[model samples]
Target: MTSNDIRFDCQHRGDGGPLVIVPRIDGTPLTELVDGFEIAAGMQPAGDAYGGLIPEFFRFGPMQDHFLGRSTNTMGPKTPVLGCECGEWGCWPLMARITATADFVTWDAFEQPHRKARDYVAFGPFQFDRHQYDDALQALSAEIGSNVDDTRA
Candidate 1:
Protein backbone atom coordinates (compact mmCIF):
# COMPACT_ATOMS: atom_id res chain seq x y z
CA MET A 1 0.00 0.00 0.00
CA THR A 2 2.32 2.72 -1.16
CA SER A 3 1.19 6.36 -1.44
CA ASN A 4 2.77 8.76 -3.94
CA ASP A 5 6.14 9.45 -5.49
CA ILE A 6 8.80 11.45 -3.67
CA ARG A 7 11.97 12.38 -5.49
CA PHE A 8 15.57 13.29 -4.64
CA ASP A 9 18.05 15.58 -6.30
CA CYS A 10 21.51 16.63 -5.18
CA GLN A 11 21.39 19.72 -7.36
CA HIS A 12 18.11 21.13 -6.12
CA ARG A 13 17.33 24.34 -8.05
CA GLY A 14 14.01 25.56 -6.76
CA ASP A 15 11.91 25.97 -3.64
CA GLY A 16 8.30 25.07 -2.83
CA GLY A 17 5.97 22.70 -4.69
CA PRO A 18 5.73 22.02 -8.44
CA LEU A 19 9.47 21.99 -8.90
CA VAL A 20 11.17 21.92 -12.26
CA ILE A 21 11.12 18.19 -11.86
CA VAL A 22 13.65 15.95 -13.55
CA PRO A 23 15.49 12.78 -12.60
CA ARG A 24 17.75 12.14 -9.63
CA ILE A 25 21.15 13.73 -10.00
CA ASP A 26 22.92 11.51 -7.52
CA GLY A 27 22.54 8.71 -5.03
CA THR A 28 24.90 6.44 -3.15
CA PRO A 29 27.00 4.33 -5.46
CA LEU A 30 25.78 0.73 -5.67
CA THR A 31 28.69 -0.49 -3.54
CA GLU A 32 28.04 2.19 -0.95
CA LEU A 33 24.26 1.71 -0.99
CA VAL A 34 24.67 -2.00 -0.30
CA ASP A 35 27.47 -1.37 2.17
CA GLY A 36 25.25 1.06 4.05
CA PHE A 37 23.08 -1.84 5.06
CA GLU A 38 26.12 -3.64 6.35
CA ILE A 39 27.31 -0.58 8.25
CA ALA A 40 23.92 0.29 9.70
CA ALA A 41 23.12 -3.34 10.38
CA GLY A 42 20.09 -2.96 8.08
CA MET A 43 18.45 -0.65 10.59
CA GLN A 44 17.11 1.66 7.82
CA PRO A 45 15.21 -0.95 5.81
CA ALA A 46 15.55 -0.39 2.09
CA GLY A 47 12.63 0.82 -0.09
CA ASP A 48 10.45 3.93 0.26
CA ALA A 49 6.89 3.12 1.29
CA TYR A 50 5.21 6.46 1.94
CA GLY A 51 3.90 6.05 -1.61
CA GLY A 52 4.88 5.19 -5.22
CA LEU A 53 6.83 2.14 -6.50
CA ILE A 54 10.55 2.93 -6.37
CA PRO A 55 12.01 0.41 -3.96
CA GLU A 56 15.73 1.07 -3.90
CA PHE A 57 18.61 2.77 -5.70
CA PHE A 58 22.34 2.07 -6.09
CA ARG A 59 25.21 3.33 -8.18
CA PHE A 60 27.29 0.19 -8.42
CA GLY A 61 24.82 -2.48 -7.39
CA PRO A 62 22.15 -4.07 -9.64
CA MET A 63 19.86 -1.09 -9.13
CA GLN A 64 21.87 1.26 -11.26
CA ASP A 65 19.67 2.81 -13.95
CA HIS A 66 16.56 4.38 -12.45
CA PHE A 67 16.19 2.86 -8.94
CA LEU A 68 16.19 -0.53 -7.31
CA GLY A 69 12.65 -1.84 -7.50
CA ARG A 70 10.79 -0.10 -10.27
CA SER A 71 7.58 -2.09 -9.70
CA THR A 72 8.19 -4.69 -6.97
CA ASN A 73 10.73 -7.25 -5.86
CA THR A 74 11.15 -10.45 -3.85
CA MET A 75 11.91 -8.44 -0.73
CA GLY A 76 15.58 -8.76 0.10
CA PRO A 77 17.95 -6.85 2.31
CA LYS A 78 16.53 -3.46 1.34
CA THR A 79 16.76 -0.11 3.09
CA PRO A 80 14.76 3.10 3.14
CA VAL A 81 15.94 6.62 3.73
CA LEU A 82 14.05 9.59 5.18
CA GLY A 83 13.86 11.08 1.67
CA CYS A 84 15.84 14.01 0.28
CA GLU A 85 13.28 16.60 1.41
CA CYS A 86 10.83 16.44 4.27
CA GLY A 87 8.51 19.21 5.32
CA GLU A 88 9.85 22.50 3.98
CA TRP A 89 13.40 21.30 4.45
CA GLY A 90 15.42 18.36 3.25
CA CYS A 91 15.59 15.50 5.68
CA TRP A 92 18.81 14.28 4.10
CA PRO A 93 21.23 15.13 1.36
CA LEU A 94 20.40 13.68 -2.10
CA MET A 95 23.22 11.39 -3.14
CA ALA A 96 24.81 12.24 -6.47
CA ARG A 97 25.22 10.41 -9.86
CA ILE A 98 22.20 8.09 -9.81
CA THR A 99 19.03 8.93 -11.69
CA ALA A 100 15.87 7.00 -10.79
CA THR A 101 13.11 5.64 -13.08
CA ALA A 102 9.66 4.68 -11.84
CA ASP A 103 6.15 3.62 -12.85
CA PHE A 104 5.04 7.23 -12.45
CA VAL A 105 6.37 10.20 -10.59
CA THR A 106 7.01 8.51 -7.25
CA TRP A 107 8.24 11.55 -5.40
CA ASP A 108 7.99 14.92 -7.01
CA ALA A 109 5.17 15.75 -9.48
CA PHE A 110 6.96 16.05 -12.78
CA GLU A 111 6.66 16.02 -16.56
CA GLN A 112 8.98 15.64 -19.53
CA PRO A 113 10.61 18.46 -21.54
CA HIS A 114 7.46 19.19 -23.54
CA ARG A 115 5.45 19.46 -20.39
CA LYS A 116 7.92 21.93 -19.04
CA ALA A 117 7.41 24.02 -22.14
CA ARG A 118 3.68 24.04 -21.60
CA ASP A 119 4.19 25.14 -18.03
CA TYR A 120 6.42 27.91 -19.25
CA VAL A 121 3.70 29.08 -21.59
CA ALA A 122 1.09 28.91 -18.88
CA PHE A 123 3.22 31.20 -16.76
CA GLY A 124 2.05 34.01 -19.10
CA PRO A 125 3.74 36.08 -21.73
CA PHE A 126 7.44 36.74 -21.40
CA GLN A 127 8.27 40.38 -21.07
CA PHE A 128 11.83 39.58 -22.00
CA ASP A 129 12.91 38.21 -25.34
CA ARG A 130 11.76 34.59 -25.81
CA HIS A 131 14.88 33.86 -27.83
CA GLN A 132 17.20 34.17 -24.86
CA TYR A 133 15.00 32.00 -22.68
CA ASP A 134 14.46 29.51 -25.45
CA ASP A 135 18.16 29.04 -26.10
CA ALA A 136 18.99 28.86 -22.44
CA LEU A 137 16.19 26.46 -21.63
CA GLN A 138 17.06 24.22 -24.55
CA ALA A 139 20.70 24.03 -23.54
CA LEU A 140 19.94 23.25 -19.94
CA SER A 141 17.27 20.75 -20.90
CA ALA A 142 19.68 18.97 -23.22
CA GLU A 143 22.23 18.65 -20.47
CA ILE A 144 19.66 17.27 -18.09
CA GLY A 145 18.25 14.95 -20.77
CA SER A 146 21.65 13.42 -21.43
CA ASN A 147 22.21 12.69 -17.79
CA VAL A 148 18.68 11.37 -17.36
CA ASP A 149 19.00 9.00 -20.31
CA ASP A 150 22.28 7.65 -18.99
CA THR A 151 20.77 7.07 -15.59
CA ARG A 152 17.78 5.27 -17.03
CA ALA A 153 19.89 3.18 -19.39
Candidate 2:
Protein backbone atom coordinates (compact mmCIF):
# COMPACT_ATOMS: atom_id res chain seq x y z
CA MET A 1 0.00 0.00 0.00
CA THR A 2 1.08 3.55 -0.64
CA SER A 3 2.01 5.92 2.15
CA ASN A 4 -1.12 7.97 1.59
CA ASP A 5 -3.37 4.97 2.15
CA ILE A 6 -1.94 4.19 5.56
CA ARG A 7 -3.01 6.30 8.53
CA PHE A 8 0.25 8.11 9.17
CA ASP A 9 -0.42 9.48 12.64
CA CYS A 10 -0.59 6.24 14.58
CA GLN A 11 1.51 5.89 17.73
CA HIS A 12 4.16 3.24 18.23
CA ARG A 13 3.63 1.33 21.41
CA GLY A 14 5.10 -1.87 22.77
CA ASP A 15 4.38 -4.05 25.79
CA GLY A 16 8.01 -5.10 26.43
CA GLY A 17 8.14 -6.94 23.14
CA PRO A 18 7.81 -6.08 19.44
CA LEU A 19 6.27 -2.71 18.80
CA VAL A 20 2.70 -2.47 17.62
CA ILE A 21 1.68 0.44 15.43
CA VAL A 22 -1.81 1.33 16.50
CA PRO A 23 -4.06 3.49 14.41
CA ARG A 24 -5.78 6.46 15.95
CA ILE A 25 -9.07 5.14 14.74
CA ASP A 26 -10.52 2.52 17.04
CA GLY A 27 -11.27 -1.05 15.89
CA THR A 28 -8.39 -1.06 13.45
CA PRO A 29 -6.04 -3.99 13.73
CA LEU A 30 -2.40 -3.09 14.30
CA THR A 31 -1.53 -5.89 11.93
CA GLU A 32 -2.59 -3.68 9.06
CA LEU A 33 0.85 -2.17 9.22
CA VAL A 34 2.57 -5.50 8.70
CA ASP A 35 3.19 -4.78 5.02
CA GLY A 36 2.25 -1.10 4.84
CA PHE A 37 4.75 0.33 7.30
CA GLU A 38 8.52 0.17 7.46
CA ILE A 39 10.45 1.10 10.60
CA ALA A 40 13.09 3.73 9.90
CA ALA A 41 16.08 4.61 12.04
CA GLY A 42 15.63 8.16 10.98
CA MET A 43 14.69 8.78 7.38
CA GLN A 44 15.78 5.36 6.22
CA PRO A 45 14.82 1.84 7.29
CA ALA A 46 17.31 -0.28 9.18
CA GLY A 47 19.11 -3.01 7.26
CA ASP A 48 19.09 -6.63 8.37
CA ALA A 49 21.00 -7.55 11.54
CA TYR A 50 23.68 -9.23 9.40
CA GLY A 51 24.61 -5.87 7.93
CA GLY A 52 24.91 -2.69 9.96
CA LEU A 53 22.39 0.00 9.16
CA ILE A 54 23.48 3.49 8.15
CA PRO A 55 22.18 6.62 9.80
CA GLU A 56 20.42 8.74 7.20
CA PHE A 57 19.55 11.81 9.23
CA PHE A 58 23.08 13.12 9.54
CA ARG A 59 23.60 16.79 8.59
CA PHE A 60 26.26 15.78 6.11
CA GLY A 61 24.00 14.37 3.37
CA PRO A 62 22.22 16.81 1.05
CA MET A 63 18.72 15.52 1.74
CA GLN A 64 19.37 15.09 5.45
CA ASP A 65 20.77 18.65 5.60
CA HIS A 66 17.60 19.91 4.01
CA PHE A 67 15.45 17.91 6.42
CA LEU A 68 17.43 19.04 9.47
CA GLY A 69 17.36 22.64 8.29
CA ARG A 70 13.58 22.64 8.16
CA SER A 71 12.83 22.81 11.84
CA THR A 72 9.45 21.73 13.11
CA ASN A 73 7.42 23.72 15.60
CA THR A 74 8.07 21.19 18.34
CA MET A 75 11.85 21.44 18.13
CA GLY A 76 13.11 24.57 19.86
CA PRO A 77 16.39 26.42 19.19
CA LYS A 78 18.80 24.07 17.45
CA THR A 79 20.92 22.34 20.04
CA PRO A 80 24.68 22.35 19.45
CA VAL A 81 24.50 18.63 18.69
CA LEU A 82 21.18 18.40 16.91
CA GLY A 83 22.33 16.30 13.99
CA CYS A 84 25.59 14.83 15.18
CA GLU A 85 26.09 11.09 14.46
CA CYS A 86 28.07 10.54 17.65
CA GLY A 87 27.07 6.83 18.01
CA GLU A 88 25.44 7.80 21.24
CA TRP A 89 21.68 7.86 21.71
CA GLY A 90 22.24 11.51 20.75
CA CYS A 91 19.54 12.88 18.48
CA TRP A 92 15.96 11.76 18.79
CA PRO A 93 14.20 9.87 15.98
CA LEU A 94 14.99 6.59 17.73
CA MET A 95 12.47 4.95 15.43
CA ALA A 96 10.42 6.89 12.95
CA ARG A 97 6.72 6.07 12.63
CA ILE A 98 3.94 8.09 11.10
CA THR A 99 0.87 9.02 13.12
CA ALA A 100 -2.58 10.05 12.00
CA THR A 101 -2.96 12.67 14.70
CA ALA A 102 -1.66 16.17 14.04
CA ASP A 103 -2.41 17.26 17.59
CA PHE A 104 0.58 15.39 19.02
CA VAL A 105 3.31 17.22 20.94
CA THR A 106 6.45 18.35 19.13
CA TRP A 107 10.09 18.21 20.20
CA ASP A 108 11.35 19.67 23.47
CA ALA A 109 15.04 19.40 24.33
CA PHE A 110 14.44 19.80 28.03
CA GLU A 111 12.48 16.54 27.95
CA GLN A 112 15.43 14.28 27.19
CA PRO A 113 15.52 11.84 30.09
CA HIS A 114 18.66 10.75 31.87
CA ARG A 115 19.49 7.17 32.85
CA LYS A 116 19.24 8.05 36.50
CA ALA A 117 15.47 8.50 36.19
CA ARG A 118 13.39 5.81 37.86
CA ASP A 119 11.36 5.39 34.70
CA TYR A 120 12.19 6.80 31.29
CA VAL A 121 9.86 7.13 28.35
CA ALA A 122 10.67 9.29 25.36
CA PHE A 123 8.81 9.66 22.11
CA GLY A 124 9.22 12.30 19.43
CA PRO A 125 7.15 13.21 16.43
CA PHE A 126 9.23 12.54 13.37
CA GLN A 127 8.70 15.31 10.85
CA PHE A 128 9.72 14.05 7.45
CA ASP A 129 8.35 14.06 3.93
CA ARG A 130 7.02 10.71 2.77
CA HIS A 131 8.52 11.13 -0.69
CA GLN A 132 11.91 11.77 0.79
CA TYR A 133 11.62 8.64 2.91
CA ASP A 134 10.64 6.58 -0.11
CA ASP A 135 13.60 7.90 -2.07
CA ALA A 136 15.98 7.11 0.74
CA LEU A 137 14.58 3.59 1.06
CA GLN A 138 15.07 3.00 -2.63
CA ALA A 139 18.62 4.29 -2.46
CA LEU A 140 19.45 2.03 0.45
CA SER A 141 17.98 -0.99 -1.31
CA ALA A 142 20.08 -0.21 -4.37
CA GLU A 143 23.20 0.14 -2.30
CA ILE A 144 22.61 -3.21 -0.67
CA GLY A 145 21.99 -4.84 -4.01
CA SER A 146 25.17 -3.33 -5.39
CA ASN A 147 27.13 -4.70 -2.48
CA VAL A 148 25.71 -8.18 -3.05
CA ASP A 149 26.65 -7.98 -6.73
CA ASP A 150 30.22 -6.92 -5.90
CA THR A 151 30.53 -9.77 -3.43
CA ARG A 152 29.40 -12.25 -6.07
CA ALA A 153 31.81 -10.91 -8.67
Candidate 3:
Protein backbone atom coordinates (compact mmCIF):
# COMPACT_ATOMS: atom_id res chain seq x y z
CA MET A 1 0.00 0.00 0.00
CA THR A 2 1.01 3.61 -0.43
CA SER A 3 1.48 6.33 2.19
CA ASN A 4 -1.88 7.74 1.11
CA ASP A 5 -3.33 4.31 1.79
CA ILE A 6 -2.57 4.96 5.43
CA ARG A 7 -5.16 7.36 6.79
CA PHE A 8 -4.05 10.43 8.72
CA ASP A 9 -6.71 10.54 11.39
CA CYS A 10 -4.99 11.01 14.75
CA GLN A 11 -6.95 12.16 17.77
CA HIS A 12 -6.17 13.87 21.06
CA ARG A 13 -7.89 12.28 24.05
CA GLY A 14 -7.62 14.75 26.91
CA ASP A 15 -8.21 12.11 29.60
CA GLY A 16 -6.58 9.25 27.76
CA GLY A 17 -2.98 8.04 27.62
CA PRO A 18 -0.22 10.60 27.99
CA LEU A 19 0.41 10.34 24.26
CA VAL A 20 -0.27 7.89 21.48
CA ILE A 21 1.12 7.29 18.03
CA VAL A 22 -1.14 5.00 16.11
CA PRO A 23 -0.35 3.62 12.66
CA ARG A 24 -3.45 1.93 11.28
CA ILE A 25 -3.81 0.08 8.04
CA ASP A 26 -7.07 -1.07 6.44
CA GLY A 27 -8.38 -4.62 6.02
CA THR A 28 -5.49 -6.57 7.32
CA PRO A 29 -5.22 -8.89 10.32
CA LEU A 30 -2.11 -6.95 11.31
CA THR A 31 -3.96 -3.66 11.10
CA GLU A 32 -4.64 -3.22 14.79
CA LEU A 33 -2.21 -0.51 15.90
CA VAL A 34 -2.51 -1.01 19.65
CA ASP A 35 0.46 -3.33 19.59
CA GLY A 36 2.28 -1.02 17.24
CA PHE A 37 1.33 2.13 19.13
CA GLU A 38 3.80 1.78 21.97
CA ILE A 39 4.96 4.88 23.84
CA ALA A 40 8.62 5.83 23.99
CA ALA A 41 11.00 8.21 25.83
CA GLY A 42 9.94 10.99 23.47
CA MET A 43 6.89 11.57 21.29
CA GLN A 44 8.61 9.90 18.34
CA PRO A 45 5.84 10.55 15.86
CA ALA A 46 6.20 14.28 16.42
CA GLY A 47 9.91 13.90 16.80
CA ASP A 48 12.19 12.55 14.07
CA ALA A 49 10.68 9.05 14.24
CA TYR A 50 7.99 9.28 11.63
CA GLY A 51 9.97 11.58 9.37
CA GLY A 52 7.90 14.56 10.49
CA LEU A 53 4.89 12.23 10.15
CA ILE A 54 2.22 14.63 11.33
CA PRO A 55 1.65 18.31 10.82
CA GLU A 56 4.29 20.32 12.59
CA PHE A 57 1.34 22.67 12.85
CA PHE A 58 3.64 24.87 14.84
CA ARG A 59 5.44 27.03 12.32
CA PHE A 60 5.61 28.60 8.90
CA GLY A 61 8.20 28.24 6.19
CA PRO A 62 8.75 30.57 3.20
CA MET A 63 5.27 30.09 1.73
CA GLN A 64 3.84 30.91 5.11
CA ASP A 65 6.23 33.75 5.88
CA HIS A 66 5.08 35.50 2.73
CA PHE A 67 1.30 35.10 3.01
CA LEU A 68 -0.12 33.37 6.10
CA GLY A 69 2.61 34.70 8.42
CA ARG A 70 0.11 36.30 10.77
CA SER A 71 -2.75 33.77 10.71
CA THR A 72 -0.29 30.86 10.74
CA ASN A 73 -0.67 29.13 14.09
CA THR A 74 1.84 26.39 14.55
CA MET A 75 5.03 26.77 16.67
CA GLY A 76 7.07 29.77 15.66
CA PRO A 77 9.79 32.16 16.98
CA LYS A 78 12.53 30.60 14.90
CA THR A 79 15.68 28.78 15.99
CA PRO A 80 18.47 26.88 14.27
CA VAL A 81 18.08 24.13 16.80
CA LEU A 82 14.58 23.36 15.57
CA GLY A 83 15.89 23.39 12.06
CA CYS A 84 14.29 21.57 9.16
CA GLU A 85 15.75 20.41 5.89
CA CYS A 86 12.50 21.77 4.54
CA GLY A 87 13.70 25.18 5.70
CA GLU A 88 10.98 27.90 5.77
CA TRP A 89 8.71 24.96 5.10
CA GLY A 90 9.27 23.86 8.66
CA CYS A 91 5.79 22.35 8.40
CA TRP A 92 4.04 22.11 5.21
CA PRO A 93 2.21 20.48 2.28
CA LEU A 94 -0.68 19.85 4.68
CA MET A 95 -0.08 16.13 4.51
CA ALA A 96 -3.51 14.49 4.65
CA ARG A 97 -2.86 10.95 5.89
CA ILE A 98 -0.75 11.10 9.04
CA THR A 99 -3.37 12.78 11.18
CA ALA A 100 -2.00 13.74 14.60
CA THR A 101 -3.70 15.33 17.60
CA ALA A 102 -1.43 16.20 20.50
CA ASP A 103 -2.22 17.01 24.16
CA PHE A 104 0.59 19.37 25.04
CA VAL A 105 1.38 21.02 28.35
CA THR A 106 0.76 24.05 26.26
CA TRP A 107 -0.48 24.81 22.75
CA ASP A 108 3.01 25.86 21.73
CA ALA A 109 5.74 23.25 21.15
CA PHE A 110 8.39 25.94 21.65
CA GLU A 111 7.53 25.82 25.32
CA GLN A 112 7.41 23.06 27.93
CA PRO A 113 9.37 19.78 27.78
CA HIS A 114 11.17 21.73 25.12
CA ARG A 115 13.15 24.18 27.25
CA LYS A 116 14.79 21.06 28.63
CA ALA A 117 16.30 20.47 25.22
CA ARG A 118 19.78 21.80 24.62
CA ASP A 119 18.22 23.00 21.41
CA TYR A 120 14.60 23.68 22.23
CA VAL A 121 13.18 24.09 18.77
CA ALA A 122 14.91 21.56 16.57
CA PHE A 123 14.78 18.76 19.10
CA GLY A 124 14.45 18.45 22.84
CA PRO A 125 12.74 16.72 25.70
CA PHE A 126 9.05 16.90 24.88
CA GLN A 127 7.26 17.91 28.03
CA PHE A 128 3.69 16.90 28.78
CA ASP A 129 1.63 16.40 31.92
CA ARG A 130 3.25 13.72 34.07
CA HIS A 131 0.13 11.62 34.47
CA GLN A 132 -0.49 11.60 30.76
CA TYR A 133 3.14 11.37 29.68
CA ASP A 134 3.84 8.57 32.11
CA ASP A 135 0.95 6.46 30.91
CA ALA A 136 2.13 6.81 27.38
CA LEU A 137 5.73 6.38 28.48
CA GLN A 138 4.82 3.15 30.25
CA ALA A 139 3.34 1.68 27.13
CA LEU A 140 6.40 2.66 25.17
CA SER A 141 8.63 1.37 27.90
CA ALA A 142 6.98 -2.01 27.52
CA GLU A 143 7.67 -1.96 23.81
CA ILE A 144 11.33 -1.35 24.47
CA GLY A 145 11.38 -4.34 26.76
CA SER A 146 9.67 -6.35 24.06
CA ASN A 147 11.54 -8.04 21.25
CA VAL A 148 9.59 -6.35 18.49
CA ASP A 149 10.61 -3.05 17.00
CA ASP A 150 7.95 -0.86 15.39
CA THR A 151 10.40 1.78 14.30
CA ARG A 152 11.15 -0.40 11.28
CA ALA A 153 7.59 0.13 10.14
Best by lDDT: 1
Q: Tell me, what's the RMSD of every candidate? A: 17.6, 18.3, 17.9
Candidate 1: what lDDT?
A: 0.28
**Candidate 2 local lDDT, 29-90, one digit each (tens):** 32222112323313132222111112232232332222233323223333211211222224
Give TM-scores for every candidate, taking all chains together and pairing residue i with residue i.
0.21, 0.27, 0.21
List candidate 1 stretches off by more than 4 Å: 1-126
Screening candidate 2 with a backbone cut-off below 3 angstroms (N, C-alpha, C), the clashing residue pairs are 8-98, 8-99, 8-100, 9-99, 9-100, 10-99, 10-100
Off by over 4 Å in 3: 1-128, 148-153
- Quick one: best TM-score, which candidate? 2
lDDT of 3 by residue, 7-85 (tens): 1123332453112223223421111221132122243333322211122333333221212123244434422212222
Using lDDT as the yardstick, the better of models 1 and 3 is 1
C-alpha lDDT of residue 123 in model 3: 22
TM-score of 1: 0.21
